[model samples]
Target: MVVTDVSRPDAGSPGTMPVRRKRSRIPGWLRGVIWAVIAIAVISTASYSTGAAALTSSNTASTALRLALPILLCALGGLWAERAGVVNIGLEGMMILGTWGAAWGSYNGGVWAGLVAALAFGALGGLLHAVATVTFNVNHIVSGVAINLLGLGVTKYLANLIFAPVSGNPRQSPVVPKFDTYSASFLSDWLGGLEKEQRVGISDVAGILRGLVTEVAPLTMIAIILIPLSYYILWRTRFGLRLRSCGENPVAAESLGVNVYLHKYVAVVISGAFAGMGGASLVLLRGGADYLENQTNGRGYIGLAAMIFGNWRPGGLLGGAALFGYADGLQLAGGGEAVLALLYGAVILVGVIVVVQLFRRQWIAAGLGVVGAGVLYAIYWSNDTLPSDLIPYTAHFVTLIVLAVASQRLRPPQADGQPYRRGED
Candidate 1:
């Protein structure tokens, strides 16, 4: 009898290749859109059921966008550095320097000058980081910590010397010029009128759109433009490919005649520029026309978290920022009640997860998802209001939960944060 192993059909065939089935899955962008639609539906239902008008209010959306901008910029900064295999834990410090630079320049020149100074100062910070990590080969984390210390100490001394002399406050800078904001006059008016009509889904959509077009700042517009620009430069352009190569494998990149050090230096510098722009946004937009001590208040750290949550992609980073911003905005717009509505939305989201896990035959995960959904639903049913203290930290709590869930799927650069020297095999 001839024994032919069906499972080993290609075992003895050296030149033959196995034909595998191609699995069809949803495109990433389309999946994102589908998830977004589900989230919106859940939140809209929560808003109506709970009578939380602020959940979909235009003012809340505006506040969320304003609050998200700084985080978005900082995350972009981190993305640039990490993509070049340079770990930048000094983003907070760079932002500090930018704030001081913005104040000094705006005081001396104008808001535009302030922005230029911020970028210059931020680039300086990045340069210092590059000198420590890339040139001297210091531990990336240690160098980052030192940069943070240096940024804080240097900015403090400068603030005392420059700001105190003018404002008579060591911790505060003198009044700086504020940037003008634009709104679509007739269109914004029409949207506002439509939103005020309060026609459930239609009104909510109108309200969200109105917020986008109303009182929009030039910097905000520029920041939004940078998202797509960064995507194009980093994913489409040859320079981006070379830079990213340095992060993935410096030795391999150098073998291919790519300038690893130069690319890293450029990336770190651009990182600092983005961080500085974030600081400039605070001073010029929502910071009461002046730089204040600790105005950042850990926003740089939050931006880093946002970056990680996004899995080092610009689009993901934007979503993370928007999520945190919306949570905070809900707290600001309607206090505890609005946030309570988020709990209901969370329940719906978890329920959807349970369904997905079940479909995938992930029995254990589906069970956990069901429990989580049940617990969240119970919380929503029982609590009419979240505690005052907890409400202030709503965004942070949401960030933590999101990071925990997203942690499973992250795929960072292979050589990220690894020390590399030229010609070292």
Candidate 2:
């Protein structure tokens, strides 16, 4: 019948080459969802087994959100500056300035005024950074360190002058107004009932959702909205393109008339403003808006870690902040028992990694994963609770581990931390 076989390209046609079908890769959002699901399952199982209800409780989730807010803001600040080719090592300093400004503003005016003052103070810190690194071409790291010192000294002195009289403490300020929180009308109640059921994964998810919808502060809502807003501005807008180009290649951007210097300046200034807002979050929420000495307590550096873990993206940083905040919140909620439950969770997570590594024929990695899982399980079995002193460092430990794991996948701005000057090719 001489029927032509159309299925095989190379079968009938002369000099035809067979085409290979490309493998479909999972979308980033889908991958994130899968990982989140896996994490939830692991934590939920651990929570049930250990009877550590705090692991999945609404209180813990709420605490995590509260703790994560400042870090998220600071990370966002770092993202803005780095994306525009400026390395903002002075985020801590900007945040410090923000705390003072927030306390002062809140005491004199109100919570809203405090927020505005925080942004202004942070912008001031950013301006100093820009003047040093952008105008004078100072070393980014050096300038950042100097700015940190300056922020600390200036704030301390100001606190003594302004706050000490009323509070009777140089490192403290008078009580300021705090933002009120809101809960979704019916959703919070519905979710709370579902969470009370304690039905494994479903209950765990409900608790998390309940926490999100219940008693959420206005500032928290603002911080959450910034994530998507940042994505749209940086990825979709022309100004964002120019800013990112400056970070990637300032000379190239300048060649294209992108005004690299101006973009860098604006980016750094914005970065400071964000950090300042982070500081404001801490002050306004902590103990009814009272400013305490060293309230930031290295959150600035932690936020920078979150930024790195996120690989310099808004969504990624949010996850990183959430992770650190969760660790911190768990310790605060359930004390040592909660931290112990986390060990069990780690064991399960490591076991999953081992299985994945085995499937990929990664013999060494799988072997290491097995050992890690075994050690973690052993620790979990032996200890009923983690040491009290160690609880405070749980977030830091999480930060180091997460950074180590994610470091290989990170790709920072090409010209990050590099000094740039006009007319210099």
Candidate 3:
């Protein structure tokens, strides 16, 4: 946000600029709506134009939702921690702990118990990070790395000690109960018949609406609700304001008599809770048979990416998560439809860019977009599509491109990594 002068004639320290630049003052709600519309336009054009059966299928939709929920939750976790002035790189470790906690809780109590246990374990991990970075003034990144190492070591050691004996597998745990799925075959058939695992009619708005309601995981439902819930709590409420302020400038918050350390601790602990929820989803998404050492993979890191992509906003986070999830779903479902659909989506984006440029009177930019669209059409006419191997992760490429293009629009807390001490201005 601070724009400084690099060139100065006499430069002990260049005085602050007297001139202030006007900035756009778009409301948050309106910005969200705009983002949603753009996302829908791009996704819709890709889905229908390419005949991406997998993208449209009920199974693909279900899978994407499932995959997106965990990532969204983790992103929310990162949002909480970072927004509170703590850079938490230990989300992966917290998630790993949640896997074991979920397994243990499920084994002892039930599915719900698994969730509670996951939260507890994640909270513990968060606490460790907070104690080191917040209380002791350790470097935040160093503390996070330590937590990750400790979590990995402890989980592996415990798995060998406990899970190996119980399930006869050192790397995996025994099965536990999982959530049930609901069916809507009639709706699918009525919606123009499923092309792969879904009915090939995304623009059939009716079908898409019905599809979301049916065959959904309970956790997915929770995650969807949490999106708006997070937005309301973080951006709408007074307490949320305080929380965000703490991240932006803890010293200023402290001057206002805010319990800076307390708030930071609370933010990080909450962050862990959300991450734990994500871990539970990972286990219970299927038949909760076992917890594997490598289940989390790099999803925790990806979640951080999603948060940045969303500009640290909840709704934006949802879109980013959904985009990533869609890619994974196509890969899981395995088909050519997803690949074709992505190409079509690219074409749609090209058109959108050209239209926006034309409206803005950017003739050169508009012309380039037109040219790009023409090339895409030529490819379509020549019978071309994205490679099958790349279909599964097209979203990653999109995420990177988006981040590059809109980097200026995205901002983090001004004091995100600066250590705060009491009585300091």
Best by TM-score: 2
How big is the positional error of residue 216 in model 3, measured in Å on the Cα after superposition? 2.2
When 1 and 2 are scored with lDDT, the better candidate is 2
Best by lDDT: 2
Score every model by TM-score: 0.91, 0.93, 0.82
> In candidate 3, what are the lDDT values of residues 167-194, reduced to their tens digit?
9988998887776776566775555343
Candidate 3: C-alpha RMSD to true structure equals 8.0
Model 3 residue 88 lDDT score: 86
Which residue pairs clash within candidate 3? 46-345, 57-198, 58-198, 194-198, 194-199
Model 2: how far residue 206 lies from native, Å: 0.8
Q: Lowest summed-lDDT stretch of 10 residues in model 2?
A: 399-408
Q: What is the C-alpha lDDT of each candidate?
A: 0.83, 0.86, 0.75
Candidate 1 Cα outliers beyond 4 Å, as residue runs: 1-18, 286-289, 357-375, 406-408
Residue 295 CA error for candidate 1 (Å)? 1.3
